[model samples]
Target: MNHRGVEFTVAKTAIPGIWQWQFRIGEETKTGKTETKIDLLAIRRVQLRIDRELKAIGQRTGPEPESGGMVAGENA
Candidate 1:
């Protein structure tokens, strides 16, 4: 289930200062029909997990790749 091209949002939870990020990627079924729903809590958890994993990988790999400097005569 790729979430690309879908709409999503990030919001703060009602409890104090907790944060929650939500994503809606529609849905799918074996019969070719889908019923989309908003599982805000679940989406938030998924985002947190992904963030943790990415951070771990970045730490192990020593920062992400950077873009090279532009050429002297390059047009903008």
Candidate 2:
């Protein structure tokens, strides 16, 4: 399943009210769990996490340029 360019999978666990969500991006895989079975909620949770990971790896998802931009700690 693809949501806003992010591909993920949601499956039921052995325990009730617990669902596992897994996202696959390139060679990396991210997984998480939620108490609700709503796919939208699960997708949102995964999206936020993926965004954070992307930003950490210097790959931001937006119109902002990757290079020639002011960094967070640089003195202007």
Candidate 3:
């Protein structure tokens, strides 16, 4: 399933009520298992997880400099 540019898949594990989900963004792949029987809820959970990860990824990379000048925290 695809939501907000994120694509993921959900499958039921052998343990019964466990749902496994995985998604890929750029070169990063994330996977997890949740204790939910509903597919919709699984998707929603993955979407929320995606949102949080994307935010964290953005924060980690930060923004690029426009003028090719010295980057932040760089020594002269």
Using Cα atoms with residue i matched to residue i, what is each candidate's TM-score against the true structure? 0.35, 0.56, 0.74
- In candidate 3, stretches whose alpha carbon ends up further than 4 angstroms from where it belongs are 63-76
In order, the Cα lDDT scores of the candidates are 0.47, 0.75, 0.88
For model 3, where is the 10-residue window of minimal lDDT?
A: 63-72
Candidate 3: residue 34 lDDT (0-100): 92
Q: Please, what are the lDDT tens digits per residue for candidate 3 over residues 1-76?
A: 8877988898999987799999999998999999987878887888899999888888999986689788789999
Question: What is the per-residue lDDT of model 1 for residues 1-76, given as tens digits with 9 covering 90 to 100?
Answer: 2333434454545554455554443351111111224456545555554455556656877965567967679988
Candidate 2 lDDT over 1-76, as tens digits, reads 7765767787778987677888876688888888866757766777777777766656544565579878899999
- The local lDDT score (0 to 100) that residue 59 gets in candidate 3 is 95
Which candidate number maximizes lDDT? Answer: 3
lDDT of model 3 at position 66: 86
lDDT for model 1, please: 0.47
The C-alpha RMSD of each candidate to the native structure, in angstroms, is 12.7, 5.7, 4.8
As a TM-score, model 2 comes out at 0.56
